[model samples]
Target: MPARSSSRLSPANSRIESMTVAACGGLATPAIETAIRIRLPASSASNTRFIKRSFEAVEPPLTLDEPGRMLMGMIVRPLRVYVSPVFRRIGLMLLAAVVTLASPALPAGGQDAPATPEVAVTDRVAPVWDGTYRRIRVPILMYHYVSPLPENADEYRRELTISPDTFRAHLEYLFFEGFTPISLYDLDEALLTGRELPAKPVVLTFDDGYIDHYTHVFPLLKQYGFTGTFFIITGRVDARDPNYVSWEQVGEMAAAGMDMEPHTKNHVSLQGRDYDFLVYEMLGSIESIKAHTGRQPHLFSYPVGQYDADTLAVARTLPIWRAVTTANGRYHTTDNRLEMPRVRITGGMSAPALASVLRGD
Candidate 1:
């Protein structure tokens, strides 16, 4: 007997035929023969109806001619007689391609994008400072005496004093914590050109020209290899004064790298004073310091941080470069050079507190 031909279809053969028709949009006799030879699985009649509806919605209607039209109709009639699963598979594949193309691109590293700069650990060791931002500022500390109190001297003790032990601890803390003691001249250079200071920078200043400042503080400063500024009251140097430093000591300090700037004649507040007295206080102190030390002091310290608009006006008129005030804050670029703020280091401040203040924390 001759070999019998199977009427039932298979899934694989149906998929191949459907893909060929979708790709070429036409069927020949050879294609139909090839599709029939590969046995395709039969799908449900409802599925065939759905696929036909979907195909008609997507594709333009075809017009038939004589021989090709007859062949196409015969092929589609068998496809409708036995439904095939190929159309559903093709739809799923096209849907997957669309979803993949529509999605957003992921980060190169296959993770969410970083929102901030990744600062390296090495950068933290030596921070590179650009001068654009006004974040950090130099701290200039002001002190007066280092003396233990006498039993019945409350008024004398409360003025401006720190014990020797406290002062030593403060210096040691600054030294160990990488602070470089800078002079007022160095500060002027930094202000003019935004230069990078040492890891830490601090300036030591003493006010009021007290005898104890020369007698006690100078020796300790010299021992520690540190320099400081001393603002002197010009008239009180040798005018029958037991409490103030003499002109001889002022000259000595000036010779030993310590600056001796003028702090007015009588240490009087310049706020409500007459213009003549202000001029006398301003110019007279400059003249007296020049006469004694042979070099005019270029800096000034306000008496008790008390100054008014007239005082600032007078300061602007003079050739003075900088002045110190007993203000309670860190020195910023916006600070007035004539009214520059100084952190007063007193008997109450500990080593850590002093360090914190110097670091502008």
Candidate 2:
């Protein structure tokens, strides 16, 4: 493909060109004599000179030295030669085609290219960074399983899993206590732009993209008129793991205003990984989430809450705006965005316990 020219077509010219292109089917060569021509009335010399001067005043000069601007002359010259409407229309369309061919507006990648809209999710806005950071107390509650554990579940599973009842209690407390559930994207924007959040703003984030999130937590959140963010393991979804959320479920949640972000391709730790491995894991999950959600993820969750300097550097290089860790705290700042901390929601924790944790008691 030829390189696109840097010059921009004026809006008036662009509209005219577009209409002409539509009328002519974008064909450059046609039997001009056979084509319909509407003869324009002859203008007085004074009027013609005035019109020419007006055109010159509004339109920039075209020269061979600037190929990008040369196409304008082609369309303008036709108007001066004869008062035939067909010739002028054809010239306008040819100019449009020339400009389009010379500098296509389409991206280098085809239709399926990953596009990050201004807002990652609906009912949201892009964050504005004003070269400063603000400290705020917004508790980001992190969860794993919202379902009860099996008899054979090990200590690790026991530590992570929270019963559905306990999860409901947490939501109830949040709802009744006037805590507004927000996504990480909301927090990011609020902190960056000095935007005020609702009273008692709290973030609900689910890690690992578990099926329990879709089945148990999703409905409960909807019931309370709340929203949450889910960090997903793409490999598990791809492998059709019954325990993990399928791509269909992920899409459903994303469509319902859930903030779906990437954990990693295979839930790998970012602590000691090389650049190639980091890119593969990070981009793989990011692209997969983008494909399903139609919005590129701006947040990431570190597997096992482990990361080093390389992890932070790679995250900064990618589309990632902020990342959460297993570190315990509710006080978030713009300076520590990439290493934002969360309040770990442990198994068997009650609504009162959650309240206390949020209050830093």
Candidate 3:
């Protein structure tokens, strides 16, 4: 019944009141909203009896808790004989902000447990970056096929392909050894913005858009709660080749949070290509994957691990962030980001052997 306090509120609460007034189409001035808020004690127990009688002709649109309803009751009862319409509108807006920004309520029986706020994945990995470029040693395992070698397969294919059982063994080894799978984006973020990566970060990349990647690799990665980056050859997928993954399968993988990137349009080497040829191969595949998956591919796997100075120059001109190569080594730095190296996983390599390789033994 007394006048609201003339004291100033905290800067945050003042901003909230100002914004709420603006959002309500200026129907209620900041002073009015502030007045009602300053008067309502969160623990006030003037029941909903006053509100029901005051607005019997029209219902309040909000679904308020017991405390909020009580606070409304106290404010509404005083203004019912005066400007009922104006008070009703202003009361609703101020009450919503008060309840939201106020501290959590105690549970029944007055338990002391406060509701925990949900945290985002980015918040966990985001770092207070200092703007210093740094590098780290993280083995980026690369695979072509997770299937058995085809009959009479060439020596080149043998080096590129690893059997399904061997692939599963590699994942099991990594899991047991506490190797956390990360995307190239993760690596790039850490390099540029000082973002924190997992304790044991490792990158798993499957190149060339192979069909086995979707069939064998996808399910196994999901089974282990791991994610891999797949470098797609857009031309092969567009042609619907049985040996390559389809756009539908690519969509499904992208939706599942797998990193889908570009290899090239026709899987050609960019080492000696001209500017037009380079753009068509690199940017073309990038655009294709973006169209199919609704995510622009920032990471690129140079076709056949081939590139030259021209290639790097052109790649820099595009939106591509990091370009991986078949060269051996895991140490990644901002200086050589465009030519990040990978650890090749070949056939006939056991899980322990892969372990030894990753361990740098």
Q: Highest lDDT, which number?
A: 2
**lDDT for position 274 in model 2:** 59
Greater TM-score among 1 and 2 belongs to 2
Candidate 1 lDDT, 52-110, residue by residue in tens: 11222122222233544455444444443433443533332332222212222222233
TM-score of each: 0.60, 0.66, 0.64
Query: Largest TM-score belongs to which candidate?
Result: 2
TM-score of 1: 0.60
In lDDT terms, how accurate is model 3?
0.66
Summarize candidate 2's per-residue lDDT along 116-223 as a digit string, tens digits. Answer: 222242324567787665888988999999997899999889888889999999999999999999878878888888888999999999999999999999999889
Kindly report the root-mean-square deviation of model 1 from the true structure over all alpha carbons.
38.8
Model 1 stretches astray by more than 4 angstroms = 1-136
Q: Write the per-residue lDDT of candidate 3 for residues 210-318, one digit (tens) a residue.
A: 9999999999999999999999987776545799998779989998999988898778888876544565577667655665566656789999899887688667666
Q: What is model 3's C-alpha RMSD?
A: 21.2
